[model samples]
Target chain A: MVNPRLMVWLKGLAAAAVLTVALGGTPSFAQSGEETAHATDAVEHEAGVHDEKGLPQLNTKTFASQIFWLAITFGTLYVLVAKVGLPRVGAVLDAREAKISGDLDKATQLKAETDAIVAAYEKAVAEARAGAHKLLNETAVTADAAAAKRIADVVAGLAVKQKEAEARIEGQKQTALANVRAVAAEAAAAAVAKLAGVEPDQAGVDGAVDAALKERA
Target chain B: MATDPLHQFRIEQIVPLHLAGHDVSFTNSSVYMVVAAVLITALLTVGTASRALVPGRLQSVAELLYEFVSGMVRDNAGAEARPYFPLVFSVFAFVLFGNMIGMIPGTFTFTSHIIVTFALAATVFVFVTVLALIRHGMHFFSFFFPSGAPIVLAPILIPIEIISYLMRPVSLSIRLFANMMAGHTMLKVFAGFTITMIGALGAVGWLAGAVPVAINVALVGFEIMVAFLQAYVFTILTCLYIRDAIELH
Candidate 1:
């Protein structure tokens, strides 16, 4: 660890460096001194312009004041908000929520009621249709029965008229037949009387006519 | 003066007051905080005043905010988390309003402050811890070493779990604070650069400054997105924390 020659050489080098610095450092030092003066002057001027030194935030003296005011203001705010602001907003929101759900419930109820009404209307219409059908059937049956009775009465009257006409025709035919017999009997008696010159017995001729008519019957 | 990017975060006292030897002065941050509260309260109250069956614009926004947080609680923390809805809602509205209101120019961002974010995170941490203790009793300690994990690994895992659990507030606070502060700072820096460039180099600077302006224009949209995203992340994380406290998983 102890190198004597190297130590001597290091000591000489240090002496030479010191000599060099001593000789060379004077002008630089003088120059740096002027620069330092200028720097100080600038710093002084800058300091003069600024009212406060350093960061205002770092100023510990103002901490109490800031903290104090913060507490007061923050405290006041908390009170106002907790007591007034939040409740009001909460109330409004709750009210709006209640209103919405209530409206929805009402809407649902109305729809149900409407559905019931529509159902009732449909049922009434169905009953009316059934009643109308029944009425129509009853009217048709009554009209059909009346028409049938009228037709039957007309046919019965026509049958009676036909019977009476047939009886009259039969009576007329019998009368004509009686008249023909009478006329034939008269003519025969006259012919006999004219041919025989003497008056044939009228009673006898009448008796003969009667016997011949009886034979023909 | 306005060129300083950090200038925006500076708290200016609107009403100087001292109480218990502590400077309790009402500042610009407080004003915006109050304004956010008023706006949130007004939106919820006035918007729901009509109780219209069909909501209008304001009512829609109010209802959306309500449902969004409620759904978040239900989905993330489960039905058991229902009781905490108001607290969760308040936190969400406060943060969302803080972020969105900050996006407006010349407005102070309260969420950008570490103190405010830390307070919120600490409150959540305490709440969850207390809830766990109340609900689960001494069994809450079981959370440090996950069940089914090898008990032999308890030396390694328990510390890790504990550290991570304790780090919840730190991570939560830092994340929100850092994001808001960083995004706003970057916006301011770019805006200041644009002004400085235009002031220093005239026509050439105008052309050069347009680059930063364009970037800043894009950044404004990006910052707005970040604002909403960070708010969501914050609230969702809170919901998750509530879930953890309730379930101890």
Candidate 2:
């Protein structure tokens, strides 16, 4: 990441260098020298890290104050840490530790509770399935019994109707046999009259027809 | 214009004063020291006020400081040195902040001073020594002589042992002071090269001048790492000294 930024910066610098060269103006050393002199004095006046006194660190003149202030500052900081800072930080750490362990305990408990609920639900579903299966089997058995009874009823009714129709057909056949006997009598009487050239008696025809029909039976 | 790299280390009296024949003038060093202390205080004070479980950046920093110093103390000095964690931690913070603050172009570095570093080191040395004496009484002297060492070698070994023990404070103080001074001086010198080169010439000089600027940039990054490492080194070493005093190494 930094490489890309650095590349862009270098590219910009190169561009700037090219622009400066294109403009191609000479530097003003004389004027800068005067500014440099004043700047150095100002820097010395402010920080004064070097002077005729040598390294200010090694200089004995400022040692007392530095030490004095150092002692005061160091003591105050030490007091702040020992009395105030460390205890608060320690408490926060302790609380965090307790909370972490406590949260773990709660998570474990919740997991156990969920596992138990899942098991119970599965058991209830299995029981409900068994009940439905048992109900289906019971319904099937009852419907099978009902269907068998209905079929038996239909068969009984058909047998009765068939018997009634057979009786009615027998009555019609008897009536037809009687009418066929009467027609046979009439036909015999008419044949006798035509063939013998004389009218046949009804009594005689009846007798003849009765004899023939009896012989055929 | 004095283009000396050493010029950057000078201390000037912001307000000159005298008290009991001592030159106790408030200087830039003093100012930077106070600034470091205040910054450290303000950071801990405000950052930790929320005590947020999910930490913000400032709280995270504060917690980082706490855990870092506490772990350092526990690791170096064992569980018993838990009491001295605050002082050790505060000193580390101060030196760490002072070094980094000084890295800025115009700020003073108090840790570069022998007087300042020595003062801090001496306090640790005295505290550890006092603790050792109070705990061990005459037995603290036994530290100079190992149990297995022959009595014949005791004459040479004891003085050497004493000298080395005394040198601990000096070496500790000089290590931090020298590192900060050397690093800052190097930066300043390289910075001078950039300024002089860029100021004295034209377009070609800018290209040439970029060399020092590049070096300064790398140096700045390295110096920041050095600043953090030195503070840790100083702290762990202090804890080690305290451990030695307690355990009689």
Candidate 3:
């Protein structure tokens, strides 16, 4: 929006300038012979009057000059304030605002980047967790299979050893029984020969023993 | 009444010197102006020197003054106008102090005079105008002849705009000057009545004097309000002026 105030000031300055130019620039320009005469008469008429403060009455001689200077003073002041002072202030304000906005933008961009990074990191972590779970499952299955196979191999080996042990025991027992029977027979025959005179009837005895043994068997 | 108060308000030659082919007389008013300037500087310096986190009364007052002006500028001129804070703040402080100081029994109120107020107002005006011209170039003139005005009414509207625009300094100066002068004058008149009445019949004069004294006290309070109000008005106008110069619509 146009500053109504600034416009007003500019308009004042413009008017003052226009007036000055139109009135012929400065008091000297306006002070023609006729105007001076009229001024002198006006001043003489008002001379001896005094106010409550004992001050002399007004004079019209320097009226134009007063107006001129008033304009000049106002114009000069206006220029100084408008041209020099205000702009400096404005620049400071603009700079501060720009700085704040720039900071905000930087903050926003950083936040966005951080969020993206966090999301990607989270995704990677999830993938890693999933892979780890899959590996653990595969390891568990492989371990179970190896354990079962080992157990079966051990059971088969024990069965084979039991069979061999039983066969050995049976063979040894047969051998031992044969030996014992031979020894007993040898001893009994010897005793009979020595103690008794039964050796002459060997053929008859053998045939009888054979017939008895066959009947007992 | 004098066509202008300048003639009536002359500072007689307390000390006279001629310089640069002009008669220069250092008068009481001139001395006071110098004094006022120095006072402002000293007050600001002393008030702000400590720059305390928790302020003393003097510093608090100074800081309040600063905030008040800056706040006005921000509100009226927009956030973008923050850079102008110091200028606005200083102007407010100077004018405020000048007005208040003038109220003291023996102090001169520079703001009470038209020259000082006009000078201040004119400066604001010129500043804004130049800003507009620089920012908008020839288009700045369009401010006087607003766009979309019906062609038939342009003549009347243009003159009115011009007159209103020209009155900126006059209105600005008059507002401050008139308020200060009128208020002070009323106080003086009342004070005179109070004194004069006191010399009359004992009880009745005493009672009459009491009325004017009470009124004077009330006027004093009112004048204080006017002092701050004028400062606010001036600063806001400055912001508005800046906005016009910058935005032009």
Candidate 4:
């Protein structure tokens, strides 16, 4: 804080410097300086009366050359940066931006393609399921029809066998009835001969057998 | 002269050339200006000579500087100042380098000089004024008189505006000059104290000098920051003034 006050005196020194400069004194802009914190200890250490100069920048004499070089140097740097440097940096940034956007576009495109392929695969699976269902239904119907035909063939064959078996039983029954009648006639004739001395005639026996068979039927 | 904190600011003729009754001789201030220019050119041109997409440390520094000034111009001056990008960048670089180079133990700080800072400030002042004149015509004078104000207020406000406008260069030049000059002189005084203490106090006195040396070291770092800040102030102000001239508000 005490040190900062050193510049307080500089306000005057600066004014004096500016005044001297304005009044056409020596090129002594150097008089602009801060007082030491120990101004009391400064002890009048004066280099010369001319030594305590104002701001050197206010000097008229050096202005020409300094400005001259300043223009040339600063101007050249300006041109270089304007023409070359900024453009290069801009290009790098632009290229990076373009690359990023392009990559994003490509990613979107790939995602779209993947979605399309997935859709196609889903459609194929659906069609395959429908085709399998139709096949299952058609096979069931064909199996039913074949089973019905087989059952009909077995019934027809069994009916024919049943008719043949009934006819054979009827024939055997007729033969057995004829044989019993003939044997009965023979026995009756023998009994008559033994007990009453009479053998019956062929026509009589036949008549008797016919009458008996009719009664039984 | 070493004891003289102000001696470093002394201007002495090196080549002593005179032409057309004008003393245009190259001096210490002139040499530093050239040194600033060369270093800036090297920092920019050689630093970015490869122009790598991925920057090295030096190139990053160069690119950072470029973008820093670019951002300042864009922010304060608006996009119309895009064309003036190089000029602003150059001024920022020059002032920055000149100020920083001056911080070296035994070198000259040209920016501390009012002559150099004033010329720069004056040039900016002239350029902006001309720009306002060209773009706004006589309407530029209306800048002194605030718009939407009572006509009675014009008498009060116009002169104030014009005076402030004219004082722009003075303040611009002085702020940088005073800050640099004071800081440098303060450092020199402290350094002189440290040296004097070490010499006068003998073997044990060397330890007593540590305080000043430590403070001087801290001041060096602070001055470096001030160097950068002052350059930024100078450049940004230029941008704002240019923006004002262009927009005429």
Which residue runs of candidate 3 sit more than 4 Å off their true CA positions?
Answer: A1-146, A177-217, B1-24, B35-94, B122-159, B189-218, B238-249
Q: Model 4 over residues A1-217: C-alpha lDDT tens digits?
A: 3224334434645765675465344332222234432332322422121323543444455666666666766666667656765566555556657878999999999999999999999999999999999999999999899988888888888888888888888888888887888887777667767787877787787788788878998
Question: Each prediction's Cα RMSD?
Answer: 12.2, 13.4, 9.7, 7.9
Greater-TM-score candidate between 2 and 4: 4
> Candidates' DockQ values?
0.27, 0.24, 0.04, 0.22
Give a tens-digit lDDT track for model 4, residues B23-130.
Answer: 576778878888887787777767766667567887788778877888999999999988778778877888999999998978888898877888789888998999
Q: Which stretches of candidate 1 lie over 4 Å from their true place?
A: A1-51, A183-217
Full-model lDDT for every candidate:
0.84, 0.81, 0.63, 0.77
Error of 1 at A3 (Å): 54
Candidate 3: fraction of native contacts reproduced: 0.01
Can you give the lDDT of residue A25 in candidate 1? Answer: 60
TM accuracy, model 3: 0.57
Instruction: Please give, for residues A85-153, the per-residue lDDT of candidate 2 as tens digits.
Output: 778878888888899999999999999999999999999999999999999999999999999999999
Q: What's the true lDDT of residue B202 in model 4?
A: 89
Question: lDDT of candidate 4 vs native?
Answer: 0.77
For every model shown, what is its TM-score relative to the native structure? 0.82, 0.68, 0.57, 0.75
lDDT, candidate 3, A1-217, per-residue tens: 3357457656656755664364334334434566665544544432222111211112222222323333443334334444543344344445556878998999999999999999999999999999999999999999999999999999899899999999998889778755644554455456676788455354544555556556775
- Among the numbered candidates, top DockQ falls to 1
Question: In model 1, what is the error at residue A155, expressed in angstroms?
Answer: 2.4
The interface root-mean-square deviations, each candidate in sequence, come to: 12.0, 9.8, 8.6, 6.2
* Poorly placed runs, candidate 2 (over 4 Å): A1-51, A109-217, B199-203
